[model samples]
Target: MLNAKWKKMLVGSTVGAMLVVGAAGAAFAADAASPAKSEKHAAKHQAKLEQKAAAQGLTVQQLLDRQAARKAALEEKAKAAGLTMEQYKAQRQAEHQAKLEQAAAAKGLTVEQLKAQHKERHDKVVEQAKAAGLTVQQWKDRKKAEHEAKLEAKAQKKGITVEQLKAQLAAKKAAK
Candidate 1:
């Protein structure tokens, strides 16, 4: 009887240890699969800050700051036209708004209508992406392929075949 009891206890302990170890291993695996908890916290805070900045009309600096070059170009244009930079900016803004208004009027649309159309276009693109069953990177690759195919078709219409284009591209790549 004592031997049987000892055998039972040994089995129970072995099973219990295995269960504990399995639970711990699962926890460790989950932790490894996830981004660090602190990174998620930081990301949440950064998103909130970005939302606040957008609401407050604060512009983030782009990796490449085009503003200086844009300003210099505008100043040069203004000088050429015998107008101050400020005057040129105002004139351009007015012209841009006028063009927008004219386009809206021509389409029998309000500014809101134009915005809605733009949003619809964005939604359509998103829907197409979802329908494609591809990841974002994969979708981009597919788009590049489709664009190349369309370009090839156009070239074919102009008496240039895809094989010729591929050969030319290969030659150009080799030259580089």
Candidate 2:
């Protein structure tokens, strides 16, 4: 049998060890990176990039213009395959947005709910694109087709009809 003093000491030491382990676990949990910090890191890196560009006697806007020209040239290359630049941009955006919506819907957000919440962000991006001279209708058409294609692919992969998946998604959202 343990003596009273030894029993008390053992209990105290066990509690102290647990406290240390708990504190260490909390520290590890809090070690995740924040998006804002990452954004700041990127902004700082971009500033350094601009400094390099300036050393080459080029402004950031000039670099962007060059990139835009390259993109236009690529679009022309893609035209041989019957795709326009606007179509390509919209298709890419829509496919990505579709996947995001799929995941969000899987998490119980209704299509209407997701669209309503994201409409402002979408409008702001559209406004920015208009400011940058991209036509809204062209972008919308391409994006719609791409998103439809994504939904079709998802349906095919799951061995379900597109309408059935849509209904299931709707039902899931409604239950939530």
Q: What is the C-alpha lDDT of each candidate?
A: 0.77, 0.80
Error of 1 at 78 (Å): 1.8
TM-score of each: 0.40, 0.30
**Best-matching candidate per lDDT:** 2
Candidate 2, residue 30: the lDDT equals: 61
Checking candidate 2 for backbone clashes, the offending pairs are none
Runs in model 1 deviating more than 4 A are: 1-65, 119-148, 157-176
Give one digit per residue, the lDDT tens place, for model 2 in 14-73.
Answer: 999999999998877666545667888999989987976664356888866877899878
lDDT of 1 at 59: 45
Model 2: CA > 4 A from native: 1-119, 131-133
Highest TM-score model number: 1
Cα deviation of 42, candidate 1, in Å: 19
User: Where does candidate 1 clash, by residue pair?
Assistant: none
Model 1, 82-141: lDDT tens digits are 999889889999998888788888799997787789799867765776687644445666
